[model samples]
Target: MKFAAFSGVLIDHSIQEALQLTKKLGFDGIEIAAREPHLSAATSAPRVKEIRTVADGLGLDIPVIAGYMGGFSTASDKESEQAFSEFQRMLEMSETLGASMIRVGSGGPNAFLAEDYHYAKAAFWLRKCAAEARKHDKRIVLEIHNVSLVETVESGLRLLDLVGEDNVGLIHDAGNMYITDTDYGRDSVIALGRKMFHVHVKDEKRVAEAGSPGTFVNRTKHGEEKFLQCRLGEGEADHQPLFDALKETGYDGWVTLECHAPFPAYERLEHDFRKVKQMLGLA
Candidate 1:
């Protein structure tokens, strides 16, 4: 599998600078964060063209759009419609960015609806987006976040079934799965083997104290959050078995480096980049 990294981890720099850093760090691809304070997919076509040129110049293939966080659910029609519209906009940006897949979170507030209801609604939306994606020859990839309603493999599979399109796929995050209180990532690998489109490689180090209520207060405009982004191999995440499983399953997609590093952006990304490359034998 090829190596990729999230552009957000290198968010302290310009897109051109990020590309240079990624190339220097030995990543073969990139997952662009098309969100605020970064390159939003809703930007001008000329900007898209410039970014595309820079990516090509740096020899980085953008396999997916990473920060398209649109909340989707069946519990509310208005919310669902808004989500759908956001997705449509993201698809257009995906085309401009030369991204084959657009990644999204699997759960939200209305995620507690009945299984059938959730499945039907998810399927309906995916079908619509999948059609648009196909027009641009792209696919929709869903990242399985532990906090989401579709946290487990079974739920992810059910959602995939609901999506009901071959063009849809999965982006498995090892760190997220580890946090989810499950020992069955391999089981998920087996279940959604072929559907696996990309991988977000991160190792987690839990903060038991961080789980304490009101331990962190929201004083900033961005809201309160306290989880440290430790460098790879410095966390509690066990990626060895996960890597083994992916190898066994013959996964050939991009293994994107996700650095939630405790260090500064440059040092953290550089450190994690080298460490993951060595760990995955890409060195």
Candidate 2:
């Protein structure tokens, strides 16, 4: 798989600097942040041009755009309209950047209907968004985030089935699921192996008794207490099974490493990138 990095960790740096860091770390591509002071191709066309120039100058390809952040579902018409607008903006950015895919996640867990209705709403928005994406020949890879309601393997698979669009796929994150009490290392990989259009490589270490009033520590508490993001093989994330699944499914996309620990983010990011490369046998 081609390796990449998310620009969020480099929030303090410029887009060109982030791209340079990515190249130095041996990444093949990048997942640009949509919000500024980062890189939003939709809001800043000139920045997009500069980014394209830099990527071309470095011989790197931008396969994915990660600038979409407003996905909270709304029960009211006004909110829904706002959410749709945000989606449109993200799509526009994706199109401008020539990114084949855009990464997005379900908004806040405000609970949209249930069962058929839930699927209906999701399909309604996804189909509309997919139609727009099709105009630019782009795809939307929905992300499975722990804070959201639909991050589980079953939920992701069900959404894919309900949406029933080849243009829609998932951006699977191993550490996110692992921290959410899901067997993403094994089950999720098996469930959505082929449906994963992109993958985020991350791992978290559980710290007990770091804080809180409860004795029984779980994924949520453990994560909050001692959430240590680490390289692929350095944490509790089951890396071998995930890699095996990736190989079995023939997924050829960037394995973007996300750094969310307390350490100097850039230093650890480079370390994790190299670790993933060596472990994935891409080095």
* Global lDDT of model 1: 0.70
Output the worst ten-in-a-row residue range by lDDT, candidate 1: 213-222
lDDT of 2 by residue, 202-279 (tens): 777665544432122333522443455655667788777788777777777777777765557588788787777666
**Model 1: per-residue Cα lDDT over 46-77, one tens digit each:** 87778888989988898888755545553366
Candidate 2 regions exceeding 4 Å error are 70-72, 110-119, 209-226
Q: Candidates' TM-scores?
A: 0.86, 0.86
* Consecutive 10-residue window with the lowest summed lDDT within model 2: 213-222
Query: With candidate 2 superimposed using the best TM-score fit, by how many Å does residue 33's alpha carbon deviate from the native?
Result: 1.7
Residue-pair clashes per prediction, in order, are 3, 3
Could you tell me the lDDT of residue 155 within candidate 2? 70
